[model samples]
Target: MFTQRSRCLLLIFLLYFVNKISSKVEFTNIKCNTFDPDFASFEYCFLKSVNRTYKYLSIKVNLHKTPITKVKVNIAIFKRYNGYKPFLYNITKDACKFLLLKNPDPVSNYIYNGFKSFTNMNHTCPFEVSPQKLPIGYINQQVTDVLPVPHGDYLFHSNWMAYDIKRATVNVYFTIS
Candidate 1:
């Protein structure tokens, strides 16, 4: 008979499930091509050998002369290559190496040049994730940061608002064996 409010609701549900598994962070998600960029196979899902995997890729652009102001699109994550690798490989591999988070630091070469960058709109290219030198605050509109992705296919380039510059390209594919 476990009484006393059922042991305080099982100790607050085991401390909220162990603090959500100790602040869980490790990703592999490539979604946001619900097709509409003049769909014609939408350019074959922004092909590049077509195989968009992921591990921490977030892009949200919607700012055309203000109102919903959002501008946070500069995520470069890659690890393996041609064969692909590292997408939630259990998170620990240095938390998915790659960091250039928030505040005045997001533009790993090329944007507004060649299909508005994001590595030429998501294409499983670029091998080597050691691009870090960012440290502080300039992504505005709804803060959310944790850019640590490495292992394979990575290219996140977006023009998510900041005066009106349309572009979206997020192709995160990672794997580690």
Candidate 2:
């Protein structure tokens, strides 16, 4: 007894949940040493987590030898088709200028933002955390920010934060969509 629009919406919603349950994230292997060059580019370092039922992507950047001030990360989520496709929307800089301009540590940023759910309709990172940092390290496996991504095959790319910097790893946990 559902209307056509309601049925369509329900189907879409079900498909979204199905993709979330079945989707997997795979990360490329990255080897890093303290003496590695600054701003090194590493390939196959994207994230891929599969069959996860969570509702948030937990991004953790662990910093050991590398200082937090000397790290930076640029993350982009791309959709997978025959080839990888980038998300259509541009991340709003002003919406999260507080984190981008101020450069607060990851823990403080998460605390400031609080635990708010990120859905398909809402893709903005909270004011406390921005996607990229001039220099970044050690998020302590916290929910740094809400990723603007939907279910299905998507590539998670990070720059500067996932390379040869001693003991630094960028970990992203995607929640169920």
Q: Which candidate achieves the best TM-score against the true structure?
A: 2
Off by over 4 Å in 1: 1-4, 7-9, 16-159, 168-177
Best by lDDT: 2
TM-scores of all predicted structures: 0.22, 0.32
Q: Show how many residue pairs clash in every candidate, following the order shown.
A: 20, 14
lDDT of 1 by residue, 16-54 (tens): 765443222223344443222421112223212222332
Task: Please give the distance, in angstroms, between residue 135's alpha carbon in candidate 1 and its true position after superposition.
Answer: 12
